[model samples]
Target: MSAPRRPVLAGNWKMNHGPSDTARFFADFLNRLAPADDRSVVFFPPAISFAAAREALQGRPDVRLGVQNVHWEASGAFTGELSVAMAKDAGAELVLVGHSERRHVFGETSDETAKKVRAVLDGGLVPVLCVGETLDERNAGRAEAVVAEQLAPVLSIIRPDEVAELVVAYEPVWAIGTGVTATPGDAASMHHAVRERLAQAFGREAADAVPVLYGGSVKPDNAAELMSQPGVDGVLVGGASLDPGGFAAICGAAG
Candidate 1:
C-alpha cells in the first residue's frame, strides 16, 4: 500500500563459504548484477570471510557487508567471540543480532540479543535484529505471541529514535530452510503485528520507518510477491543465496 518499504535483499552465508569461496561468489555476483539504487543489498558472510567480503565488495557502493554475529563488549577475555568494535574494524557496516541459529542452537536468550543490539547501536553499526516463531509455535497458533516474546526485551531497552536505527527481520523457523514459506497473507500479518508492537513500545514514526524483513526460503519466484505485501520490507535469503545466479535473480526482482 505504501509502495512497499525500500527493498533490502540480504544473503546469510551461515557457516558456509570460506574467504576464497566468498571471493569467488562475489566475483560472479558482481558481474551478473544489474545496477540499481532502489534496493539495499547486504552480504552476511561468515566471521572468517569478513576480510574477503570487504575486499571483494570495496568501492561497490551498491553492496554492503554485514557480519552474522558480534559480541556485546568492545573487547574481552572471551575466546572465539568477535567484539562489536572488531566487526566495525572488519569493514562490516551492519550486524545480525539474535539470528534463529544463534537463539536455537547456541541457547541465546532475548536478553542477550538485546545486549548485542544495544552494543551494535552504540558502536554505530546498524543492527538487524532477527525475530521469529518456530514450527511448533505456529502450529499451536502462538506465532504472534512467540514473536512478541522474542522481541519484547529488546524493544523494552531501546528508545523510539533507537528503534529507527534498527531493522527487524521476521524469519519463521519452519520456513528457514525446509523450503516452506509463509503465504503472503501470513508474512504480512506478522509484519503488521510487529508494527503494532513497535508503535506501542516506541511510536508511530519509528514503527513506520523501521524496516520489517521476511526471511525464510525466499527465492526469485516468490520475492516480488512477498515484498509487495504491506509491512513486508525485504528478505533475508538463506540456501538460495549460495548460488550467485540465484541470488542475483532475487535481488533483481527485489530491485
Candidate 2:
C-alpha cells in the first residue's frame, strides 16, 4: 500500500524574524510558490509576527500560516506568553508545541506540552507536536522509551480519532542545527518505531492516519531521500526555511 498521504511541509522559524522580516519572508516565499498540488505547506513564524504573516498570505490559497507556539490558557496573567485564542485571532491554523528548544532551553516539560496541545485543538487549531530523543538517550538505548514517555501525556488527553488532525515531528536533539542529520535508514527506523508506539497507544487506524515528520538538520540537499522514507510523511524545516529559495526548494522536492 502507498504510504499514508498526509504530507505537510512546515517552516519552524524558531527565533528568527521580526514582523517586517516575517512579511518579507512570506511575500517572497508565497509569491514564488508554483501551486501546492501534492503537499500542504505551512509557515510557523514567531508569535509576534503571526498577524504580519497572515497579512502577507492574504488571498494566497496555496500557502497557509501557523504559529511557532501558544500558551495553554485562553487568557491569564502569563506575561510574555501568547495564548491559543490570541494565536487563532492572529490567523494561525496550526501551532507548534514541544519543540526541543522549548523543552531544553525554556524548561517546558511534556506535561506542559500536552496542555498546549490540548489548548490548540480546543481553540480549533491543529497542533504540530514535536517529540524526540537526545543523543545520550539514543546512545543509552532508550530512544523508543524516551519518545514513548514524551507521547504518553498527550495521548492521555486526546482521543485516537483526534490523531488525524495532529502532526508529530521527531527531531533528535543532537542533530538539530548541528550539521548532523540522521541517516535515511535511521530516520526511517525511528519513524516506524514512532508509528508503532502510536498504534499501541491509540489504535492501528489512528497510527496509520497520523503523519509523522522527520526534523533536525533538514536541508534541500537531503530532503528527497528523507521524504522517501516509509514513515516520514513530511518535514519540520528550520534554518533552511529562513531562506525563501531554500525552503521552496525543499517543498518542491516533496512533490
TM-score to native of every candidate shown: 0.96, 0.95
Model 1, 11-80: lDDT tens per residue?
9999999999999998999999966778889989999888998898877888998999988988879999
Q: What stretches of model 2 exceed 4 Å from their correct place? A: 1-4
Where does model 1 exceed 4 Å of error?
Answer: 1-4
Candidate 1 worst ten-residue window by lDDT: 1-10
Worst ten in a row by lDDT for model 2: 1-10
Summarize candidate 2's per-residue lDDT along 1-255 as a digit string, tens digits. Answer: 123665789888888889999888877887667876578898888877777887887787667888887889889898989988888777778889999999999999999999999998888888988999999999999988898899889988997667778788999998999989999998999889888988888788878888889999999999989999898998999999999999988998884
